[model samples]
Target chain A: MENNKIKIEFLSYSENEYIARGFVSVFASTFNPSVSWLSDVKTAVSEGVTNCIVHAYPNEIGKIILELEVNNNYLHINIYDFGVGIDNVNKAIEPFYTSKPNEERSGMGFTIMQSFMDDVKIESALNKGTSIFMCKKLLNSVEE
Target chain B: MDIKYTVSNNNLTVFVYGELDECSASQAKNILDRIINDNLNSQKVIFNLSGISFMDSTGIGLLIGRYKKLIKHNVPSYIAGATPATEKVIKLCGLYNIMPKY
Candidate 1:
Protein backbone atom coordinates (compact mmCIF):
# COMPACT_ATOMS: atom_id res chain seq x y z
CA MET A 1 0.00 0.00 0.00
CA GLU A 2 1.09 3.57 -0.61
CA ASN A 3 1.99 5.76 2.36
CA ASN A 4 -0.93 7.67 3.88
CA LYS A 5 -0.65 10.17 6.67
CA ILE A 6 -2.95 12.19 8.95
CA LYS A 7 -2.31 14.55 11.84
CA ILE A 8 -4.63 15.54 14.67
CA GLU A 9 -4.27 18.18 17.37
CA PHE A 10 -6.49 18.33 20.44
CA LEU A 11 -6.49 19.50 24.01
CA SER A 12 -5.04 17.19 26.61
CA TYR A 13 -8.34 16.69 28.36
CA SER A 14 -9.58 13.34 29.54
CA GLU A 15 -12.58 13.59 27.21
CA ASN A 16 -10.33 13.93 24.18
CA GLU A 17 -8.76 10.56 24.88
CA TYR A 18 -11.79 8.83 23.45
CA ILE A 19 -11.78 11.09 20.42
CA ALA A 20 -8.14 10.31 19.79
CA ARG A 21 -8.76 6.59 19.95
CA GLY A 22 -11.68 6.89 17.57
CA PHE A 23 -9.66 8.93 15.10
CA VAL A 24 -6.81 6.42 14.98
CA SER A 25 -9.11 3.42 14.74
CA VAL A 26 -10.99 4.94 11.82
CA PHE A 27 -7.78 5.85 10.07
CA ALA A 28 -6.49 2.32 10.52
CA SER A 29 -9.68 0.76 9.26
CA THR A 30 -8.65 1.53 5.69
CA PHE A 31 -6.12 -1.25 5.98
CA ASN A 32 -9.00 -3.63 6.65
CA PRO A 33 -7.32 -4.95 9.77
CA SER A 34 -8.98 -7.71 11.68
CA VAL A 35 -11.20 -6.93 14.60
CA SER A 36 -8.51 -7.91 17.14
CA TRP A 37 -5.84 -5.96 15.31
CA LEU A 38 -8.02 -2.86 15.18
CA SER A 39 -8.79 -3.19 18.85
CA ASP A 40 -5.08 -3.44 19.64
CA VAL A 41 -4.39 -0.26 17.73
CA LYS A 42 -7.18 1.59 19.51
CA THR A 43 -5.96 0.43 22.89
CA ALA A 44 -2.42 1.51 22.14
CA VAL A 45 -3.62 4.89 20.94
CA SER A 46 -5.70 5.34 24.07
CA GLU A 47 -2.74 4.55 26.32
CA GLY A 48 -0.52 7.04 24.50
CA VAL A 49 -3.06 9.88 24.63
CA THR A 50 -4.01 9.15 28.22
CA ASN A 51 -0.36 9.49 29.20
CA CYS A 52 -0.30 12.95 27.71
CA ILE A 53 -3.42 13.98 29.59
CA VAL A 54 -2.65 12.37 32.95
CA HIS A 55 1.12 12.81 33.15
CA ALA A 56 2.24 15.42 30.64
CA TYR A 57 -0.29 18.13 31.49
CA PRO A 58 -1.20 17.10 34.98
CA ASN A 59 -1.90 20.56 36.33
CA GLU A 60 -3.25 22.32 33.22
CA ILE A 61 -4.51 21.64 29.73
CA GLY A 62 -2.01 21.32 26.89
CA LYS A 63 -2.03 20.42 23.23
CA ILE A 64 -1.59 16.81 22.10
CA ILE A 65 -0.58 15.97 18.56
CA LEU A 66 -1.43 12.58 17.13
CA GLU A 67 0.00 11.59 13.79
CA LEU A 68 -0.81 8.42 11.89
CA GLU A 69 1.05 7.00 8.93
CA VAL A 70 0.51 3.80 7.03
CA ASN A 71 3.34 2.31 5.02
CA ASN A 72 2.73 -1.04 3.44
CA ASN A 73 0.94 -2.97 6.17
CA TYR A 74 2.66 -1.16 9.04
CA LEU A 75 0.83 1.45 11.10
CA HIS A 76 2.89 4.21 12.65
CA ILE A 77 1.64 6.46 15.44
CA ASN A 78 3.27 9.48 17.00
CA ILE A 79 1.75 11.14 20.08
CA TYR A 80 3.27 14.35 21.39
CA ASP A 81 2.62 16.66 24.33
CA PHE A 82 4.27 19.97 25.23
CA GLY A 83 3.89 19.72 28.96
CA VAL A 84 6.02 18.75 31.91
CA GLY A 85 8.29 16.09 30.46
CA ILE A 86 9.34 12.87 32.05
CA ASP A 87 12.44 12.92 34.22
CA ASN A 88 13.25 9.31 33.41
CA VAL A 89 11.89 7.45 30.43
CA ASN A 90 13.46 4.11 31.33
CA LYS A 91 11.95 4.04 34.79
CA ALA A 92 8.65 5.29 33.45
CA ILE A 93 8.32 2.32 31.12
CA GLU A 94 8.85 -0.18 33.84
CA PRO A 95 5.79 -2.25 34.60
CA PHE A 96 3.85 -1.20 37.70
CA TYR A 97 5.93 1.97 37.88
CA THR A 98 3.63 4.96 38.22
CA SER A 99 4.30 8.55 39.16
CA LYS A 100 0.74 9.09 40.33
CA PRO A 101 0.04 6.08 42.44
CA ASN A 102 -2.42 7.98 44.58
CA GLU A 103 -4.61 8.68 41.59
CA GLU A 104 -5.00 4.94 40.99
CA ARG A 105 -2.46 5.04 38.21
CA SER A 106 -1.28 1.52 37.44
CA GLY A 107 1.87 2.80 35.70
CA MET A 108 1.09 0.41 32.85
CA GLY A 109 0.57 3.02 30.12
CA PHE A 110 3.91 2.52 28.40
CA THR A 111 3.86 -1.16 29.06
CA ILE A 112 0.47 -1.51 27.44
CA MET A 113 1.60 0.48 24.42
CA GLN A 114 4.66 -1.67 24.04
CA SER A 115 2.65 -4.83 24.36
CA PHE A 116 0.04 -3.90 21.75
CA MET A 117 2.47 -2.38 19.25
CA ASP A 118 5.54 -4.00 17.76
CA ASP A 119 7.78 -0.96 18.23
CA VAL A 120 7.64 1.76 20.90
CA LYS A 121 10.01 4.69 21.36
CA ILE A 122 10.00 7.71 23.69
CA GLU A 123 11.77 11.09 23.70
CA SER A 124 11.28 13.66 26.43
CA ALA A 125 13.03 16.36 28.42
CA LEU A 126 12.09 17.91 31.73
CA ASN A 127 9.87 21.05 31.49
CA LYS A 128 9.74 20.63 27.74
CA GLY A 129 7.55 17.77 26.47
CA THR A 130 7.42 14.12 25.46
CA SER A 131 6.90 12.28 22.21
CA ILE A 132 5.95 8.62 21.89
CA PHE A 133 6.28 6.80 18.58
CA MET A 134 4.82 3.37 18.01
CA CYS A 135 4.46 1.00 15.08
CA LYS A 136 2.55 -2.21 14.47
CA LYS A 137 2.45 -4.57 11.51
CA LEU A 138 -1.16 -5.14 10.54
CA LEU A 139 -2.13 -8.52 9.23
CA ASN A 140 -2.78 -8.57 5.50
CA SER A 141 -6.50 -8.45 4.85
CA VAL A 142 -6.26 -9.94 1.38
CA GLU A 143 -6.20 -13.70 1.27
CA GLU A 144 -3.28 -15.38 -0.39
CA MET B 1 -20.00 6.71 30.79
CA ASP B 2 -23.00 5.33 32.69
CA ILE B 3 -22.83 3.08 35.73
CA LYS B 4 -25.62 1.01 37.23
CA TYR B 5 -25.47 -0.96 40.42
CA THR B 6 -27.43 -4.04 41.41
CA VAL B 7 -27.54 -5.56 44.85
CA SER B 8 -28.49 -9.18 45.33
CA ASN B 9 -28.13 -10.85 48.65
CA ASN B 10 -24.68 -9.75 49.91
CA ASN B 11 -23.17 -9.11 46.50
CA LEU B 12 -23.01 -5.74 44.72
CA THR B 13 -22.63 -5.80 40.92
CA VAL B 14 -21.60 -2.71 38.97
CA PHE B 15 -22.44 -2.51 35.30
CA VAL B 16 -20.30 -0.17 33.19
CA TYR B 17 -21.57 1.28 29.95
CA GLY B 18 -19.31 3.04 27.44
CA GLU B 19 -15.57 3.03 26.90
CA LEU B 20 -13.41 2.73 30.02
CA ASP B 21 -10.58 4.94 28.89
CA GLU B 22 -9.08 7.95 30.66
CA CYS B 23 -12.04 10.06 29.54
CA SER B 24 -14.49 8.09 31.63
CA ALA B 25 -12.22 6.62 34.30
CA SER B 26 -12.54 9.51 36.76
CA GLN B 27 -16.30 9.66 36.58
CA ALA B 28 -16.57 5.90 36.75
CA LYS B 29 -14.23 5.85 39.70
CA ASN B 30 -16.35 8.30 41.67
CA ILE B 31 -19.59 6.55 40.85
CA LEU B 32 -18.22 3.07 41.58
CA ASP B 33 -16.70 4.24 44.82
CA ARG B 34 -19.98 5.74 45.94
CA ILE B 35 -21.75 2.53 45.12
CA ILE B 36 -19.18 0.48 47.02
CA ASN B 37 -19.35 2.85 49.98
CA ASP B 38 -23.09 2.77 50.13
CA ASN B 39 -22.99 -1.01 50.11
CA LEU B 40 -20.07 -1.59 52.43
CA ASN B 41 -21.90 -4.39 54.12
CA SER B 42 -21.94 -6.36 50.89
CA GLN B 43 -19.75 -9.46 50.79
CA LYS B 44 -18.46 -9.01 47.25
CA VAL B 45 -18.21 -6.53 44.39
CA ILE B 46 -18.50 -7.58 40.76
CA PHE B 47 -17.76 -5.42 37.74
CA ASN B 48 -19.83 -6.33 34.69
CA LEU B 49 -18.08 -5.13 31.53
CA SER B 50 -20.46 -6.55 28.93
CA GLY B 51 -21.43 -3.03 27.91
CA ILE B 52 -17.85 -1.76 27.85
CA SER B 53 -17.03 -1.07 24.21
CA PHE B 54 -13.35 -0.30 24.79
CA MET B 55 -10.80 -0.25 27.57
CA ASP B 56 -7.16 0.67 28.17
CA SER B 57 -4.83 0.83 31.13
CA THR B 58 -7.12 3.42 32.64
CA GLY B 59 -9.61 0.63 33.09
CA ILE B 60 -7.02 -1.29 35.06
CA GLY B 61 -6.47 1.64 37.37
CA LEU B 62 -10.18 2.06 37.82
CA LEU B 63 -10.64 -1.57 38.75
CA ILE B 64 -7.58 -1.66 41.02
CA GLY B 65 -8.75 1.50 42.71
CA ARG B 66 -12.14 -0.02 43.36
CA TYR B 67 -10.52 -3.23 44.51
CA LYS B 68 -8.51 -1.33 47.08
CA LYS B 69 -11.64 0.41 48.33
CA LEU B 70 -13.55 -2.84 48.62
CA ILE B 71 -10.75 -4.64 50.41
CA LYS B 72 -10.67 -1.94 53.05
CA HIS B 73 -14.24 -2.83 53.80
CA ASN B 74 -13.25 -6.52 53.83
CA VAL B 75 -15.05 -7.03 50.54
CA PRO B 76 -13.54 -8.80 47.55
CA SER B 77 -13.89 -7.80 43.91
CA TYR B 78 -14.50 -9.99 40.84
CA ILE B 79 -14.72 -9.31 37.12
CA ALA B 80 -17.63 -10.46 34.97
CA GLY B 81 -18.60 -10.20 31.30
CA ALA B 82 -15.26 -8.84 30.05
CA THR B 83 -15.01 -9.12 26.30
CA PRO B 84 -11.98 -10.81 24.77
CA ALA B 85 -10.37 -7.46 24.02
CA THR B 86 -10.90 -6.10 27.48
CA GLU B 87 -9.94 -9.42 28.99
CA LYS B 88 -6.62 -9.30 27.15
CA VAL B 89 -5.84 -6.00 28.82
CA ILE B 90 -7.04 -7.20 32.18
CA LYS B 91 -4.79 -10.23 32.02
CA LEU B 92 -1.82 -8.22 30.72
CA CYS B 93 -2.03 -5.92 33.73
CA GLY B 94 -2.37 -8.89 36.11
CA LEU B 95 -5.63 -7.43 37.41
CA TYR B 96 -6.85 -10.94 38.06
CA ASN B 97 -4.35 -11.22 40.88
CA ILE B 98 -6.27 -8.63 42.81
CA MET B 99 -9.74 -9.06 41.38
CA PRO B 100 -10.26 -12.52 40.01
CA LYS B 101 -12.72 -13.22 37.20
CA TYR B 102 -16.06 -14.59 38.23
Candidate 2:
Protein backbone atom coordinates (compact mmCIF):
# COMPACT_ATOMS: atom_id res chain seq x y z
CA MET A 1 0.00 0.00 0.00
CA GLU A 2 1.75 3.11 -1.25
CA ASN A 3 1.20 6.22 0.87
CA ASN A 4 -0.95 3.96 3.06
CA LYS A 5 -4.29 5.38 1.93
CA ILE A 6 -7.09 3.06 2.89
CA LYS A 7 -10.87 3.05 3.13
CA ILE A 8 -13.35 0.65 4.72
CA GLU A 9 -17.09 0.30 5.22
CA PHE A 10 -18.64 -1.55 8.14
CA LEU A 11 -21.88 -2.09 9.97
CA SER A 12 -22.69 0.43 12.68
CA TYR A 13 -22.80 -1.99 15.56
CA SER A 14 -21.17 -1.74 18.95
CA GLU A 15 -19.37 -5.00 18.25
CA ASN A 16 -17.61 -3.34 15.32
CA GLU A 17 -16.05 -0.88 17.71
CA TYR A 18 -13.20 -3.31 18.13
CA ILE A 19 -12.72 -3.56 14.38
CA ALA A 20 -12.61 0.21 14.15
CA ARG A 21 -10.13 0.45 16.99
CA GLY A 22 -7.89 -2.26 15.58
CA PHE A 23 -8.03 -0.88 12.06
CA VAL A 24 -6.85 2.58 13.06
CA SER A 25 -4.26 1.24 15.45
CA VAL A 26 -2.76 -0.85 12.65
CA PHE A 27 -2.89 2.04 10.21
CA ALA A 28 -1.20 4.31 12.72
CA SER A 29 1.53 1.70 13.16
CA THR A 30 3.32 2.89 10.03
CA PHE A 31 4.23 6.05 11.91
CA ASN A 32 5.98 4.02 14.59
CA PRO A 33 4.26 5.98 17.33
CA SER A 34 4.90 5.46 21.00
CA VAL A 35 2.56 3.36 23.09
CA SER A 36 1.09 6.55 24.54
CA TRP A 37 0.71 8.11 21.08
CA LEU A 38 -0.96 4.97 19.82
CA SER A 39 -3.35 4.97 22.76
CA ASP A 40 -4.33 8.53 21.98
CA VAL A 41 -5.02 7.64 18.36
CA LYS A 42 -6.98 4.57 19.31
CA THR A 43 -9.08 6.42 21.83
CA ALA A 44 -9.83 9.18 19.35
CA VAL A 45 -10.87 6.68 16.73
CA SER A 46 -13.05 4.83 19.22
CA GLU A 47 -14.93 7.94 20.25
CA GLY A 48 -15.63 8.84 16.64
CA VAL A 49 -16.77 5.36 15.70
CA THR A 50 -18.74 4.87 18.89
CA ASN A 51 -20.60 8.07 18.31
CA CYS A 52 -21.82 6.80 14.97
CA ILE A 53 -22.94 3.47 16.35
CA VAL A 54 -24.66 4.77 19.48
CA HIS A 55 -26.17 8.02 18.27
CA ALA A 56 -26.32 8.30 14.51
CA TYR A 57 -28.56 5.38 13.78
CA PRO A 58 -30.24 5.27 17.23
CA ASN A 59 -30.37 1.46 17.64
CA GLU A 60 -30.88 0.69 13.96
CA ILE A 61 -27.79 -0.66 12.27
CA GLY A 62 -26.45 1.52 9.48
CA LYS A 63 -23.21 1.99 7.59
CA ILE A 64 -20.04 3.66 8.77
CA ILE A 65 -17.32 4.63 6.33
CA LEU A 66 -13.76 5.07 7.49
CA GLU A 67 -10.96 6.66 5.49
CA LEU A 68 -7.41 6.83 6.69
CA GLU A 69 -4.18 8.22 5.26
CA VAL A 70 -0.66 8.53 6.45
CA ASN A 71 1.34 11.67 5.63
CA ASN A 72 4.92 11.34 6.78
CA ASN A 73 4.65 11.02 10.57
CA TYR A 74 1.13 12.36 10.62
CA LEU A 75 -2.07 10.32 10.33
CA HIS A 76 -5.40 11.63 9.13
CA ILE A 77 -8.65 9.78 9.83
CA ASN A 78 -12.17 10.39 8.65
CA ILE A 79 -15.23 8.54 10.02
CA TYR A 80 -18.52 9.14 8.28
CA ASP A 81 -22.02 7.99 9.23
CA PHE A 82 -25.05 8.56 7.02
CA GLY A 83 -27.74 8.59 9.69
CA VAL A 84 -29.40 11.24 11.78
CA GLY A 85 -27.22 14.32 11.64
CA ILE A 86 -26.35 16.59 14.52
CA ASP A 87 -28.68 19.52 14.90
CA ASN A 88 -26.11 21.74 16.58
CA VAL A 89 -22.46 21.13 16.00
CA ASN A 90 -21.34 23.79 18.46
CA LYS A 91 -23.29 22.35 21.38
CA ALA A 92 -22.36 18.82 20.49
CA ILE A 93 -18.62 19.24 20.99
CA GLU A 94 -18.94 20.95 24.30
CA PRO A 95 -17.73 19.04 27.31
CA PHE A 96 -20.33 17.33 29.49
CA TYR A 97 -22.92 17.69 26.73
CA THR A 98 -24.66 14.55 25.54
CA SER A 99 -27.95 13.81 23.84
CA LYS A 100 -28.29 10.45 25.53
CA PRO A 101 -27.70 11.11 29.16
CA ASN A 102 -29.93 8.21 30.12
CA GLU A 103 -27.34 5.91 28.64
CA GLU A 104 -24.89 7.20 31.26
CA ARG A 105 -22.79 8.78 28.55
CA SER A 106 -20.11 11.00 29.98
CA GLY A 107 -20.55 13.48 27.16
CA MET A 108 -16.85 13.29 26.51
CA GLY A 109 -16.79 11.59 23.14
CA PHE A 110 -15.88 14.64 21.04
CA THR A 111 -13.82 16.06 23.84
CA ILE A 112 -11.75 12.90 23.97
CA MET A 113 -11.34 12.83 20.20
CA GLN A 114 -10.26 16.45 20.04
CA SER A 115 -7.97 16.09 23.02
CA PHE A 116 -6.17 13.03 21.66
CA MET A 117 -5.81 14.22 18.06
CA ASP A 118 -3.83 17.22 16.91
CA ASP A 119 -6.79 18.46 14.89
CA VAL A 120 -10.50 17.63 14.78
CA LYS A 121 -13.12 18.88 12.36
CA ILE A 122 -16.84 18.12 12.17
CA GLU A 123 -19.33 18.66 9.38
CA SER A 124 -22.97 17.73 9.55
CA ALA A 125 -26.35 18.55 8.05
CA LEU A 126 -29.65 17.80 9.71
CA ASN A 127 -31.36 14.66 8.39
CA LYS A 128 -28.19 13.97 6.39
CA GLY A 129 -25.25 12.79 8.46
CA THR A 130 -22.01 13.67 10.27
CA SER A 131 -18.36 13.33 9.39
CA ILE A 132 -15.54 13.47 11.89
CA PHE A 133 -12.08 14.29 10.62
CA MET A 134 -9.19 13.97 13.03
CA CYS A 135 -5.44 14.11 12.67
CA LYS A 136 -2.65 13.12 15.05
CA LYS A 137 1.11 13.65 14.92
CA LEU A 138 3.03 10.56 15.76
CA LEU A 139 5.87 10.69 18.23
CA ASN A 140 8.49 9.17 15.95
CA SER A 141 10.11 11.62 13.58
CA VAL A 142 9.67 10.95 9.89
CA GLU A 143 12.45 8.95 8.33
CA GLU A 144 13.76 10.56 5.19
CA MET B 1 -14.44 -9.65 27.53
CA ASP B 2 -14.61 -11.84 30.62
CA ILE B 3 -14.82 -10.24 34.03
CA LYS B 4 -13.77 -12.05 37.19
CA TYR B 5 -13.41 -10.78 40.69
CA THR B 6 -11.91 -11.81 43.99
CA VAL B 7 -12.93 -10.59 47.39
CA SER B 8 -10.80 -10.71 50.46
CA ASN B 9 -11.27 -9.10 53.89
CA ASN B 10 -14.26 -7.18 52.62
CA ASN B 11 -12.29 -5.63 49.79
CA LEU B 12 -13.03 -6.49 46.17
CA THR B 13 -10.66 -6.47 43.24
CA VAL B 14 -12.22 -6.94 39.83
CA PHE B 15 -10.00 -8.02 36.97
CA VAL B 16 -11.03 -7.24 33.43
CA TYR B 17 -9.76 -9.72 30.88
CA GLY B 18 -10.02 -8.32 27.38
CA GLU B 19 -11.08 -5.16 25.65
CA LEU B 20 -13.39 -2.85 27.59
CA ASP B 21 -15.67 -0.83 25.37
CA GLU B 22 -19.33 -0.33 24.51
CA CYS B 23 -19.88 -3.96 23.55
CA SER B 24 -18.55 -5.22 26.85
CA ALA B 25 -19.67 -2.28 28.93
CA SER B 26 -23.11 -3.75 29.57
CA GLN B 27 -21.75 -7.05 30.79
CA ALA B 28 -19.07 -5.37 32.83
CA LYS B 29 -21.59 -3.00 34.35
CA ASN B 30 -23.97 -5.79 35.25
CA ILE B 31 -21.25 -7.87 36.78
CA LEU B 32 -19.85 -4.93 38.69
CA ASP B 33 -23.26 -3.87 39.88
CA ARG B 34 -23.93 -7.30 41.28
CA ILE B 35 -20.60 -7.37 43.02
CA ILE B 36 -21.25 -4.04 44.59
CA ASN B 37 -24.74 -5.04 45.66
CA ASP B 38 -23.70 -8.32 47.15
CA ASN B 39 -20.58 -7.10 48.88
CA LEU B 40 -22.30 -5.02 51.49
CA ASN B 41 -19.30 -5.23 53.75
CA SER B 42 -16.80 -4.42 51.05
CA GLN B 43 -14.66 -1.47 51.98
CA LYS B 44 -13.10 -0.70 48.59
CA VAL B 45 -12.88 -1.73 44.98
CA ILE B 46 -9.78 -2.09 42.86
CA PHE B 47 -10.37 -2.33 39.13
CA ASN B 48 -7.54 -4.06 37.32
CA LEU B 49 -6.91 -3.07 33.70
CA SER B 50 -3.64 -4.84 33.00
CA GLY B 51 -5.35 -7.60 31.05
CA ILE B 52 -7.45 -5.16 29.09
CA SER B 53 -5.91 -5.08 25.65
CA PHE B 54 -8.05 -2.13 24.66
CA MET B 55 -10.20 0.55 26.27
CA ASP B 56 -12.12 3.61 25.20
CA SER B 57 -14.40 6.36 26.52
CA THR B 58 -17.01 3.75 27.22
CA GLY B 59 -14.54 2.13 29.53
CA ILE B 60 -14.16 5.38 31.33
CA GLY B 61 -17.92 5.65 31.57
CA LEU B 62 -18.06 2.18 33.02
CA LEU B 63 -15.41 3.03 35.57
CA ILE B 64 -17.08 6.26 36.50
CA GLY B 65 -20.49 4.66 36.72
CA ARG B 66 -19.22 2.00 39.04
CA TYR B 67 -17.23 4.46 41.06
CA LYS B 68 -20.29 6.57 41.64
CA LYS B 69 -22.24 3.60 42.83
CA LEU B 70 -19.47 2.68 45.23
CA ILE B 71 -19.42 6.20 46.53
CA LYS B 72 -23.02 5.86 47.64
CA HIS B 73 -22.17 2.64 49.42
CA ASN B 74 -19.26 4.40 51.11
CA VAL B 75 -16.91 1.97 49.43
CA PRO B 76 -14.04 3.88 47.89
CA SER B 77 -12.52 2.57 44.68
CA TYR B 78 -9.27 2.73 42.74
CA ILE B 79 -7.76 1.34 39.55
CA ALA B 80 -4.74 -0.88 39.24
CA GLY B 81 -2.58 -2.97 36.91
CA ALA B 82 -3.07 -0.73 33.89
CA THR B 83 -0.54 -1.26 31.18
CA PRO B 84 1.14 1.60 29.39
CA ALA B 85 -1.70 1.76 26.84
CA THR B 86 -4.62 1.40 29.25
CA GLU B 87 -2.99 3.78 31.67
CA LYS B 88 -2.64 6.35 28.93
CA VAL B 89 -6.36 6.22 28.18
CA ILE B 90 -7.28 6.47 31.86
CA LYS B 91 -4.90 9.35 32.48
CA LEU B 92 -5.87 11.20 29.30
CA CYS B 93 -9.52 11.21 30.29
CA GLY B 94 -8.56 12.47 33.76
CA LEU B 95 -10.08 9.32 35.20
CA TYR B 96 -6.89 8.36 36.96
CA ASN B 97 -7.04 11.61 38.82
CA ILE B 98 -10.59 10.95 39.87
CA MET B 99 -9.85 7.46 41.16
CA PRO B 100 -6.60 6.79 42.89
CA LYS B 101 -4.39 3.89 41.80
CA TYR B 102 -2.94 1.16 43.91
Per-model TM-score (chain A alone): 0.95, 0.93
Model 2 pairs in collision: none
Model 1 off-target regions past 4 Å?
A141-144
**What's the residue-level lDDT of A9 in candidate 1?**
97
Candidate with top lDDT is 1
Task: Give the Cα error of residue B50 in candidate 1, in Å.
Answer: 1.1
Per-residue CA lDDT of candidate 1, range B27-90, in tens? Answer: 8888887888899999898999999999999889888888888898799999999999999899
Q: DockQ numbers for every candidate? A: 0.88, 0.65
Estimate TM-scores for all models.
0.96, 0.92
Q: Rate residue B94 of model 1 by lDDT.
A: 96
Clashes of each: 0, 0
Interface RMSD of each: 0.7, 1.5
